[model samples]
Target: MTQATAADAATFAVAVPALGPDVRCHVLQPGRPPLFIEPAGERLLDRAQFRQWSRTVRPALDALILEHGGIVLRGFPTAGTEDFADFIEQFPAFDGGYAGGRAPRETISGRVMEATRLSASVRLAVHSEMAYRRDYPRRIAFFSRKTAEVGGETLITDVRHLAERMDPELAGRLATLGSRTAINFGPRRDADDASYAHMDERGWNQSFHTEDPAEVNRLCAERGLEPVWHEDGSLTVLNALEPFVVHPQTGRKLYRSILHMLPQVENPEQDLERRKRQKYPTGATLGNGERLTDAERAHIDQLCDQTTYSWPWRDGDVMVLDNLQVWHGRNPYQGTRDVQVALLD
Candidate 1:
């Protein structure tokens, strides 16, 4: 195929006030929130050129994210964690790190982390990053280093659209009552404890990077988490958070709840079954501690489905999302996938 000329690149470029003229931009899909960006005629694939371009267009990129909610930068030459870290350095870092996050992640480079270590068969529901907490990153970036052989598309949705489509009564209740998240950091068990062998749990020591209970308590306090300690060295924190937030620039109410991801019992019967089998269950509830009804959960799930979009990942593609404005998830896959992440405020 013939390479796109500089003039051809400019012809399809989206308007960015900071950059006088630039390469092409495409919407991820018709009427979708994320705008797609790729080098057309520019040497953005060159490392030095890519860095210079990223720095020069920082302001424009900021504007684009707020206006469009998210954007995908594809066809960039990010071969490893170092390359991804270089690109992330162009933007501000989120200092909080991933200390209290739910994902099983490992540090790949400076402020860059492996996206997740969950089983490929496990499908993740869409959620605003760290929405379960009182404090969360304003922005999150995902860099794709490898693509799965089948499936593994990153699902995204605009929470603003979800808010618009929500049932008025449910919205009213959530807005008024807010919500709470209960995160359990399972206890350490000895080799003799066969009961703990089968459960999937991340120890509190791993979550907080400290074995000292006092230090863990201090960290929890700083994040507005109410910690409850168990005799078996386990910890559970309760976080009361608002279900929605008004976008700083647009002033529109955006749905910020993790209702789609929260663990729930199918019914009262299942609730009894879970209590008998599990000691510390991580889940969410209304501020008043009432379980979300099946109908309410179904309605929220339906609204998310209506607004969701997903596309296959291409190696070296990076997705930047405004955490409050966009919700992200993972689809189950058949082969290997390597996606790294970085957070920004």
Candidate 2:
């Protein structure tokens, strides 16, 4: 269906206003259209009030989500972990995967950005965390521990909406390009004073290729994707001809890509080699020969930027976003900006 017609089955209502600018604690009506609540206050609700509200509104909210995709709740006070956990548990949509503040573990990306001394000066580009993995998160939770000095806005774009806007031919072409992305942890320091090493023996990359090879080949051919294998045992697999994904619940299509690699990171050539080595130590190859042109790369970048929607952060702001429908990112800023994130299956 189309964007204008997609949310015809959902309903929403403003449940209460706690505090903050354009923030509203909303309770979505069951089986109704999608709702967006922007409250105008900066105060947070006390724990007892929060618990009461959750009990009063959860069923309708849960039913609404089962029919629609998701909802956004804003204008909550920024407090320590216990308060947030209490609030999250009251809603079924929370998925019980807490991130941020004191209880900042169990993240889907497996990376934690602590808030105590966190800075908001870094800009995060549009991307779905762990998108390269075969089993990625379905939902993401972000609790803002602090606001930014300037331009540290959170951006999110609905990929499903973008797909609805694209031409059918383009959509079909993208769908055929179902992809296999390889990522490397690459000896990064962990919170426990240890490093996570890239493993090749376990076939972290190659072994994750669970899609049908023949189908992948067929789509690769159609998309001019050139799958290549390098001498250093690195494999370049391309599947740029897949049609966009259609969400089972929302019936919205999403464009997919292997652009998860942070292009701005150092050592492009070396990084590519490392990725290949980690994924295909014994050497690997792709069936298609499609190489992205400068124009195509620019186009993709523009698309990513334009499709993003950012939520200006406030300490204690919790955002529940559909990982499949929205691509989220952050703008660079100054000062400590800590956030805890969680992913739901």
Candidate 3:
């Protein structure tokens, strides 16, 4: 039950590309890229073998992940949600639930939930999960239940790397302002779910998992969110967030929510403009409530674009990410893709 380890930290560290600051995607394969460990003889890991891996390699796996920021566990047997949950048990999860959740997710089993219900055509902007909320998960994990025929590859960026490369003034402003955003949830369902879609809007009751308003207020207060009840029987949540968060592991400030709240008007189309009228449309601002300048936005876009890299999804591949160090997003695709997600506090 011996698992492999890198000879030195330099080789194991994610290498930055020579041509550009961007780190190229690591397309994992069988019996290659020493990072992809094949336990149980290059096949799906069996229960007993996985147990041994848990006992022996857990510390090394965590140490490697700490140095690498993220790790992919493939060639491991995960036929369904239960198996995936069992595999996840080896790595200790952070405490807390999805208090300030985004996306339409159905909890399959244990903590495993659907990644997002956003439309297939939508081009997702990269951002850390629950970045705008007061409390966020330290680790984000994804399990690929299905792989698309074409496209549908997830784009991930190492915020740890991007932090040093970002423009200093912008980073300073974000550090001071943190960032603030507001979301207004109307009583009725969002008629337009696709365009400007932020998260699953099943109604406040379902989101809070309670029908009582008093209890809902209590929960909202705990999360540092302001709950405003509209006359039309709708609720609006205003959240004050910091754009740059210090990584728990590295303690370096990393840019966050830039993509989630980049308040640019892409088109003058009716739908896009209509979403603008709503209070809850995703947006970003300085801690002082001043808007980010044009130059700052452009610089952020350049950095974000350069840092993004994607790889095709393979069935049954699971990825564990340090939420504070990496940002994840969805890319448009054809055919079908089924990815289940579970965020551990």
Candidate 4:
């Protein structure tokens, strides 16, 4: 047999993935919201085989993810936390760390982190990852270490389409006003300190990785976050960014801001204070500093629900999301669930 030229390696396929089934790929139901990629084959890939396959399909997979927002790769050879992070390393520009994120996360390895620790009964609302920060990741990946026996779907929705589907009047108002998020972080405190029950959910020392208030201020300023220190040894951070942003990859307008992970209520008209009281006055407001009416926020929440899509997590499943185009959330579940996240810049 004659040896193929080096050029054959650079551009392996001419017709853009004319050759497939290096493992089988499956999409979700035709009308379903989230794209599912199930690689079906008799045997799983060894490390070398997975690396080779990654280089071969990086182009096609990149295009597909940018176009679809999020895609799930199911039934792969991923066996555990370290193995999942290794698979993600094949892709380029993976920062391999979750930096500047508000929600608490435990670093499981160099590139992998334990997913949110929120109780199964609690719900994490749909929002873009670190949209409040000036420096935010462009990509996020999730791995299901274990699936809950009962209902727990990782909610995902297209932010661009969500923006389009929103009521024009509300959308226009948001675009004109933009949005601001005020996050208050307490001073350095033990994670299980009894005093924290009355303090912020996350402490400033943890968020900024420093016990020195001056260092926190410096870090916040560098990231376009304005910090105000209170007499009670707590810091309130305010970040205001455009509500609409152009996706770097697709050049399409995407819904870029939202009040994240707030507790939902039956009636917002009376519950605004309830949340304010419950969350220590951490809520989103207009760029000019006017509050978004509870009604308006409720409407936005409804639009998100209209577009929400998810499926039951299966062990060894991996999901990659284009952060600019997709917003993700957690669904309330009954049994135990283990989902891990890795963010890429």
Highest-lDDT candidate: 1
Predicted candidate 2 versus true structure: per-residue lDDT over 1-345, tens digit per residue: 212224433323444333323344333344222344443443225556555655666666554343344555555443655555555555334332221111112332333323212123334556654443333457665667656666666666556555656556544544554444432221212232111122222221222222344543443354444445445433344322232455666666676454322432223465467656454321111114233445555656666666555544566676666677666666766655556665554
Ranking by lDDT: 1, 4, 3, 2
The runs of at least 3 residues in candidate 4 whose Cα sits more than 4 Å from the true structure, single-residue gaps closed, are: 1-19, 31-33, 93-100, 192-199, 259-280
What is the lDDT for 56 in model 3?
A: 62
**For candidate 3, lDDT tens digit of each residue in 1-345?**
132245422223333232122112232332122233333253225656565554565566566456566677666676677777877776656565654355555567877777766667666777888776778778788889898888888777766757678777767767766777765444644333423344424466645655677877898888888888767666777788767667776778777675334422223364366566665554655657677778777777677787676766688888877787767888877888888887764
- The full ranking of all candidates by TM-score, starting with the best, is 1, 4, 3, 2
- What overall lDDT goes with each candidate model? 0.76, 0.45, 0.64, 0.68
- The alpha-carbon deviation from the true structure for residue 156 of candidate 1, after best TM-score superposition, in angstroms, is 0.5
Ten contiguous residues with the weakest lDDT in model 3: 16-25
Candidate 1, RMSD to the unseen true structure: 4.8
lDDT, candidate 3, residue 113? 77
Compared with the true structure, what per-residue lDDT tens digits does model 4 show for residues 1-345?
Answer: 122246433212212242266554334433333455544464345656665666678677777677667667766677698878887786654442333356666677877876776556556678888777767778888899988888767888766676787779988988888888876666566663321222245677766666788877777777787888877677778888888888886777777776533533324455465345433356577877777777777877887787777766789888888888888887877777888988875
* Per-residue error (Å), model 3, residue 67: 0.9
Clashes (N, CA, C under 3 Å) per candidate: 0, 44, 3, 0
Question: Which consecutive 10 residues in model 4 have the weakest lDDT in total?
Answer: 10-19
The per-prediction CA RMSD against the true structure, in angstroms, equals 4.8, 10.3, 7.0, 7.5
Best by TM-score: 1
Candidate 1 Cα outliers beyond 4 Å, as residue runs: 1-22, 189-200, 264-280
